[model samples]
Target: MFSDNREQLSRSSTFKLLLYFLACIGMIYTVFVHQVYLSSDTFHRKQLDRELSQETEIFTALAGIGNIDAIRTLIAEKQSIASPFTYHIQPISTQTASLSYPAALTGDQPYFELSDLKSGSSLLLDDDTILRIEINRDLLQKYREDLAPMMISGVALPVIVMIAGAVWFAVNIIQKLQRVNFAMNRVLCGEKNVKLAVSRNDDEFDILSIHLNFMIEQIEKKEASLKALTVGVAHDLRTPMARMKLRIESLLALTSNNQQQQELEACHDDLELLLGMFNGLLEIANLNSGKQLISKQRVDLTTVAQDAVDFLQPLAEEKQQQLILRQDAAHQLDGEPSLLFRAVINLIENAIKYTPEEGRIVVVIDAFGIVVIDNGEGISDLDKLQVCEPMYRADKSRSQSGSGLGLSLVDAVMKRHGGELVLRDNSPGLRARLYFN
Candidate 1:
């Protein structure tokens, strides 16, 4: 289940959109951090440089006035106040002759390492003395620590909120699409009354729903018209065909010549075929239109399969085929007894008609349905799908004698019972199953 769900999420457009959104957010955050780091470093460096430059200028001016004592006094004041600047004064007369300005300040060593001196400045005094000043690194460190939390919260809060909103939006869109998909599936399953609900919010989804409903309405009208036309034509032709059959039977009775009698018998058989085809067409149309209601009762599927097998056994034996039934127990379900019987009969009849001589046929009855398997010339994979359609004959079955309405009628009956007719390749033959819910 976990793997299935992960695969589904990987295929979902919403998940892909979410990943894209996160990637974009990450990129923006990275750029923001880069810019913030550069700006902060530049600002702190400039502040440090200004502090060192100002200190050096003050000491150099004091030296220019030849006031070494004043410089020493000012250094002492800075040391007393615990200033962050350190000063070093050295005379040109002797290389090592340097005054620490404030001896305690020189020993204080405010910086941890040479790198800690963020900015430094030096000036040569008129008295041949050098003045040097260095700014403390603690000021920049403190500033960074203070700004760190603000920068994090500034980006973190918005990112979290945007992600939440994106997820909600993606879920909402997916749910709406699912609704439309479900309705479309129902329509594909022959539920012409199914329609997508419109929220009337005038959004894109609402507009889509409205258009789909209109399209369904148009399809329902056209389908009803076509079904009515087919039913009407078949109904009209069946009556005339029955009259023709009666007249042909009378002529057969009146004929005395053997050749004419044989010809009349052939005409009678053609009429019977036509009548059967028309009847099938009308029955299918009625079932599709819901005009033929199914009265459901407790039905024994095993009995149904046995009856179908028994009824068609002679036909199978005529071809030297072996017809068998495999039923372990009584499988009962709620369905129309006559319709289920007819469906079983149609499947078994098709097997007998298509199987070659000396072939084997088996009708297996189970809890959910019955499977009719045959070891004959099987239908191709592509033909299996089209064979269930009315009047559709596979190339292999074209030479066989059938009206091609057997599977179509069985399919309609299965649908009327809220079941399905599934066709499979039985390796060397066809496996036709009528499943009941």
Candidate 2:
């Protein structure tokens, strides 16, 4: 099955951008929550200290002129109120009436110690009376209860919005890219006029579509120009070449000199070679330009392989070589018979040309594809890739009699049939595979 997940995460800029956005949002949430928590802590601590300072001054004033009893009475009256701070007098009374006390308290500065407030100061009277005030317990829990929901909402709302936006953006971009890929595939499959629809927004995808459409147009123009030029040159040369051959033959008949006849024969052979080259070029151009009409029907590839083997058997016999066909399976495909025949012929001919005398050649028809193998010196790794290009021949095959257009023509034919021609090492020789899609 075709999958887009790997492509989206690894290749899509939109997906990567959304991931970065989410990362940044998370970082901001963490920093904002930390700072806000600290600010709330400082504000509550300052308020507590201010209240403690005010209460200390009031008690000292009430205990003026050595009136310890009055100070005690004043403390007893204030303890009746429900306040965050709970005050107590030790060595004087068991306890004051208060709902609860701060669980931890230390120092006269009224600092928090594990949810409790502890502070104490001595009152100077005629005798001695020390008043100790300690605040403790549940302060931290109460603060957290108030701050938790507010802090959570502050971060959660934006995070939710960002996540939704990221999903929406990634989906939209993927859909647009899929459409573009579909259009490009059509073009690659030989639809020269196919073009993607450019969006009005002029986004990155739109720009890419514009460039791709332009590239396709350039390719079409170049191919059309090349085909026209090849056709014109081939047409222009055919008649002159024909007339020259006829004239040379006529001259040979009239001349009685043996040397003159030999020269004329050489000229005739050269003219025939030139004609053959032109014909090959014209055929390649026609196949690549899609000018030749192809009537695709059910073609039995095993039969094709057998026919090619039969035709090349005489040539192989002349050189004392073996040419065999092994049909493991009979496969049928939709293609033009003549073109497919030409492709198989080119492969068999190439093998025959390269293979030495008494060499073995086999044409195998299997479920995978059609493969032509020869027990000869295999093509070099460097030459294998360039062998399908027009006029490209390996250095080892330089002296061989060929137009060097045979493999190029076969490559063109395979592509027209929605297939590929792959060249690989055949252990001791070369293996040419024609794969159908």
Give the candidate number with the greatest lDDT. 1
lDDT of each: 0.79, 0.78
TM-score, model 2 to reference: 0.73
Runs of candidate 1 with Cα error greater than 4 angstroms are 1-9, 12-29, 65-84, 88-118, 123-131, 142-168, 293-299, 333-337, 377-387, 395-397, 415-418
The parts of candidate 2 lying over 4 Å away from their true place are 1-35, 65-82, 92-128, 144-191, 288-303, 317-320, 331-340, 356-358, 367-369, 377-397, 411-425, 435-437
Models 1 onward score TM values of: 0.79, 0.73
Clash pairs, candidate 1, are: none
Q: How many residue pairs clash per model?
A: 0, 13
Tens-digit per-residue lDDT, 118-144, candidate 1? 456554443355555666557567777
RMSD of 2: 7.2
360: Cα error in model 1, Å: 1.9
